[model samples]
Target: MASDGESPVRLAAETWESLFRAQVAVMRKLQAGPAFKKVALNEYDVLFTLSRCPSGWLRLNELNDHVLLSQSSLSRLVERLEKRGLVARMAAPEDGRGVLLKLTDAGAELQKDIGREHVRDISGLLGPALTAAEQKELRRLTEKLRNSVGARH
Candidate 1:
């Protein structure tokens, strides 16, 4: 939902509606599964973010900043992953007090396996709908949105 005009937001109603509706439509197309047999969508999101991290590890607060879930929910999710041997919880080496989250070897392998299927699914879904140029433009717009939202990874 859009907040009140307290932020530096500026978009015509039609433009916002198009953007939002298109996003919802695409998400719906990607929602079905067998694509992510090893992990649910939200869980895969966490693993995907970690896959891009330099060390396969992130501080919990940093992870919270990047993920769509709330910090508390993420904490519980992390616990579940840990219990399943997909994630490891350890003391942050940079600082002793905070917790650090790392994907296990098993988790990384699972992520790769699921990610391959997911990418193929995306290609199959989007290829006929969007031309190559349109796909590039879509990436540009999404990147702009990411940058607007504090440029978190």
Candidate 2:
């Protein structure tokens, strides 16, 4: 039901819409930047995720949780990256059925190279739009929103 006056449900929907739209706008600008030319954005995403792993050999399923792609699609992308020598995969010792993935040295170097340029692009897009403090607040708010939803699941 629609409310004539502002309602909690309406406010929630409006907030979500604003957040999603802002993400899309920022993503489009980042996608067009030169950093992605060397590596497709999704591929870079996978590499970036792996680059952040504290230790070696992140499980494929674990990696999937961190990235935007579906399991099947991520599997294919990993295969392509493996072929290009950008990522490596192995059978999980603890779980025979599980697969583990890691960035190869080449992949690490590439991710680092692209990351520098990508950060520059991101700074250019966000620096002017929000102050450092504002960015920190936005990060905190988004993390809160994400964690709240994640906790339910």
Candidate 3:
């Protein structure tokens, strides 16, 4: 609700629908590529998250915040990666009760390999639809939304 006499801003119906449709369409295009042949998109999501961590590791709960999967599902995914030597799991040093997930050397290499192709795929799909300036603006707008959502927690 707006405070005092101020009014809250809202997206127009058409604008909202366009944004939603664009996102779904882009995601479909990105997920359809061969880059995810070796590892499923969900699995790649975990590996990619781990790759971004400076420590190359994160506690399970921490990882859960970054990925969309449920804890049980994430645990099972980690197991699959572990079985393939793509990730390693160990007890968190601070508290043995917590499990820490770390991307292995092989995992990092794999993420980097697939990530290169993924970047290319993204550019190829969006290159014609958005110009350099529009892409930058889109990124800025999306990040703003993401930060706003993250701020709630």
Candidate 4:
């Protein structure tokens, strides 16, 4: 037995949980795909961030913030990427103590390839379930949620 007020609260919580689970499932499946088999997700994230930056470079702290990784984890990942020739670290010109990470040409090419595959995967998985209008609505609603949550922090 439940009151009418409780119904809306239960419904909202259920909806949020379902949406979160679905998102996680989709991401897991995407990561398991062939295109991602060779690269860790964090590595891809770091590469993508550098690709978006001017000169394909960003400060070590900025990369950590953008990728939400611990400084030690980021340093290890950068070391691996450097070994693979996918990224390089250089001392910042203004501050010799500060370091910047830049994506190599190979990293840029890999990002482009993996990004295309990711887009294709998303389109294939979700495009049929959502009409164009619904997709737009979802984007708007998600952005609103992001903004509201960001404002709180």
Q: Which one wins on TM-score?
A: 2
Q: What overall lDDT, based on C-alpha atoms, would model 4 receive against the true structure? A: 0.88
* C-alpha RMSD in Å of predicted model 2 compared with the true structure: 2.1
Q: On TM-score, who's better, 2 or 3?
A: 2
> Which has the higher TM-score value, candidate number 2 or candidate number 4?
2
Task: Provide the overall lDDT of each model, using Cα atoms, as 2-decimal numbers.
Answer: 0.84, 0.95, 0.89, 0.88
- The stretch of ten residues in a row with the least summed lDDT in candidate 1 is 1-10
Worst 10 residues of 3 by lDDT: 4-13
* Candidates' RMSD to native: 5.1, 2.1, 3.7, 2.7
Q: Indicate the residue-level lDDT of 117 in model 1.
A: 89
lDDT of 1 by residue, 1-153 (tens): 447654334445667789889878876666675776667888988888888889777899999988889989999998998899888889987789899888899988988899898998889978998999999998998889768876564
> What TM-score, over all chains together, does every model reach?
0.84, 0.94, 0.88, 0.86
lDDT of 4 by residue, 1-153 (tens): 246556777887887999899899988988888768768877889988999997667999888878868999999999999999999899999999899889888988998899888789889888998999999999999999889988998
- C-alpha root-mean-square deviation, candidate 3: 3.7
Candidate 2 to truth, TM: 0.94
What order do candidates take by lDDT, descending?
2, 3, 4, 1
Model 2 Cα lDDT, one tens digit per residue, 78-110: 999999999999999989999999999999999
Worst 10 residues of 4 by lDDT: 1-10
| Clashes per candidate, residues 3 or more apart or on different chains | 0, 0, 0, 0
Which ranges in model 1 have alpha carbons more than 4 Å from their true place?
1-11, 149-153
Query: In model 4, what is the error at residue 12, expressed in angstroms?
Result: 5.6
- Give candidate 4 misplaced runs (Cα > 4 Å): 1-4, 7-15
